[model samples]
Target chain A: MIDWSIIAEALPAFAEGLKTTMMLLAISCGAGLVLSVPLAVARVSPHRAVWGPVWLFTYVMRGTPLLVQLFMVYHGLAQFEAVRESFAWPALRSPWFCAWLVFTLNTTAYTTEIFAGALRATPSGELEAARSLGMSEATIYRRILLPSALRRALPQYGNEVVMMMHATAIASTVTLVEITRVARDVYYNHFAPLESFGVVAVIYFVLTFGMAGLFKLVERRALRHLRPTASGVA
Target chain B: MLHGYLPAILGGLQSTLAVAATSLAIACVFGILGAAAKLSASRAARTVAGVYTTIIRGVPDLVLMLLIFYGGQIAINRLADAAGWGYVDINPFIAGTATLGFIFGAFLTETFRGAILAIPRGQMEAGQAFGLSRGQVMRRITLPQMVRHAIPGFTNSWLVMLKASALVSIIGLDDMVHRASLASAATRQPFTFYAAVALIYLALTTISILGLRWVEARYSLGVRKVEFK
Candidate 1:
């Protein structure tokens, strides 16, 4: 029932869509990783003054749906005459910018929480030892806490990256023509849902597994010290 | 304009809730079956359950929703034609709920399986040794404790599913998100409607958090709280 010729014809569009999808994923995830470190540090601050607004930001972002958040950025913001008149309007009007902004913000909130949880769970004895060794608070954070927390956060962070890749599909709704949009276009044009979506499914499956495998390699390298040695296993 | 559109969006909230509730029910059924298959001794059951969870977890929900809603409709029509049944139309509600249920069922299967595994095996063996039948041992010993262990993961899945219900709007389900879009178009105030919908979602998630906390507390009644530094 599947037509090979239709898929062959649609291959170029699919390739273009895949590029857009990867670009969106890379930009959003890159921004999210950069932004989340400081946000996560702020999240675990002892003083409410430092953490309260950060908490509220992550809470609000996490509480709502990503699609609605995307809408608020892509479609909602333009509703305001002031926003339209603002200097940011040019960038805001572009669907790619809005999708990137929304995704980066969303993933940052989630990754911040993940990193914050890891930070909080850092063994206090290590911090106490650092203190007794005359390590400054900043030194302790930079040397001991952030490194360990980040290492611990790798698995969840990897999952978040995969999720962000999947989430880029939503960009299609705002006319960004990502993988899902290409599949839909193919389906409409060729009247073959199976061939159209089936191809996209295989693409996504490969991407997802490829990402998982990459993260697994990272884990093995970064976490090699934590692994039990062959001699120690006995 | 916000006041005028409030009732219409609220009506859509009803549809959204209905879809969420129905999908949760279906997901529970699929979860139980999946968990059973995973935990069973049968090789085929285990392999099938493993594959179901892996594929569902790997793909985006939107892709799966579109695939099932569109492809399932076409597949059904083909089957009907072959059977001389004329034509078949698939309801978006069924397609949406089934897809969400099927998708989240994989998550729930892991949750339930982990919960079951968390139960001490000795308890089940002791129950059996006390002359309790296998069914009685499961019902009396395994199930009750599994509820306590499962609550947290179940809550997580439920919250995720609640947000995911919004995706159904893309499949022409007339959910709150869809309504908000329509209202945005009509009122020419996308921010107002979308913000309203976001607030509604926040309210739902907040209430669910509170409710699940209560359930967790009720189930943890006899357990000691661990104080960790």
Candidate 2:
């Protein structure tokens, strides 16, 4: 029932779409990871002054739909004459920039929460030991807390990355020619939704499982110390 | 111009709610069945549910929506033609609702399965010792407690589903997002319209959070609240 000819014709387009999808995923996730580290640290601070605004920011970002956020950055911004005439207009007008900005902001909010939870779960004894060693709060955080929290946060962060990859499909709504967009274009051209979307589905399935497998490998290595020895009996 | 279109945008909220509510009901059905299948002794049933959750979670909702709406339409029509039943037109409402329900059902499967597993094994055994039928045990001992445990995950899924309802507009469901786009186009003020819609969504989520919190409290009435040291 599937159209092989259309699939053959669309192979190159799908490959290009996959490249754009990966680019979007990489840029947004990389930026989100960098931004979330400090935000997550701030989120766990004892002083409300340090954490209140960050909490509010993450709350709003998490509460709203990412699609609305994308629209606000993309179609919404271009509505204003002042913005259109501003120095940042060229970047603002590009769909790629808008998608990247939204995705980064979106993932940062989520990852910050993940990291904050991990940070909160750090053993009190470890913190006490650091303080007993005459380490300053800065040193304690920099040298000990953040690293351990990040290690604990790895699995959740891996899930976030895979989610971000799936979320990049929404970028296609803004005309960013990602995998979903390619599928839509092919469907329109061939009027063969089965063939067009089926191929796209396979590509996404492979990417999703591939990501899951990679994370599994990373977890195995990073968490090796925690694993029980082969000869050990519980 | 936006002032004139405000009513139209507000009207779209009705459609959005209808779709969300209907899909949520359908998803609950799928979730229960999925949980049952997963917990069933039959290997085939377990595998079927496994594949359902795997495929649904692996694919993006938009892709699934497009496939079901467009592809399902063509497939149904082709079947109809062969069966001498001319021109079967699939409604976007049905397609959108079914796809959303189907997609979220996979998530709910996990939530429901986890909640069921959280119930103590001894509780079921105790019910059996009391000579309660399996159905009686499920209803009396397992299901009520499951609600308390399921609420948090259910709330998370519901909130996400509410936000996801915006996606229905892509398939021409005339939801809030679609209305906002129309208003934006007509008013030449995309920012105003989009921002307005976003605010409405935020309000919905906030209200939902409060409502779900109340439900959680009600369900946890007799449960001891552990005070963290």
TM-score of each: 0.98, 0.97
Please list the residue runs of candidate 2 whose C-alpha ends up more than 4 Å from where it truly belongs after superposition: A229-234
> lDDT for each of the candidates?
0.93, 0.92
Report the C-alpha lDDT of model 2 over A1-234, residue by residue, as the tens digit. Answer: 777999999999999999999999999999999999999999999999999999998988888889889998899998788998999999999999999999999999999999999999999999999999999999998999998899889999999998888889899899999999999999999889988888898889899999999998988888776678888953
Query: What tens digits encode model 1's per-residue C-alpha lDDT throughout B43-145?
Result: 9999999999999888999999999999999999999999999989999999999999999999999999999999999999999999999999989999888
Cα RMSD, model 1: 1.3
Measured against the true chain A, the candidates' chain A TM-scores are 0.97, 0.97
Looking at candidate 1 chain A, the ten consecutive residues that score lowest on lDDT are A225-234
Worst 10 residues of 1 chain B by lDDT: B1-10
Cand 1, B chain, TM: 0.97
Model 2 per-residue lDDT at A45:
95
The candidate that achieves the highest DockQ relative to the unseen native structure: 1
Q: Tell me the chain A TM-score of model 1.
A: 0.97
Give stretches of model 1 more than 4 Å off. none
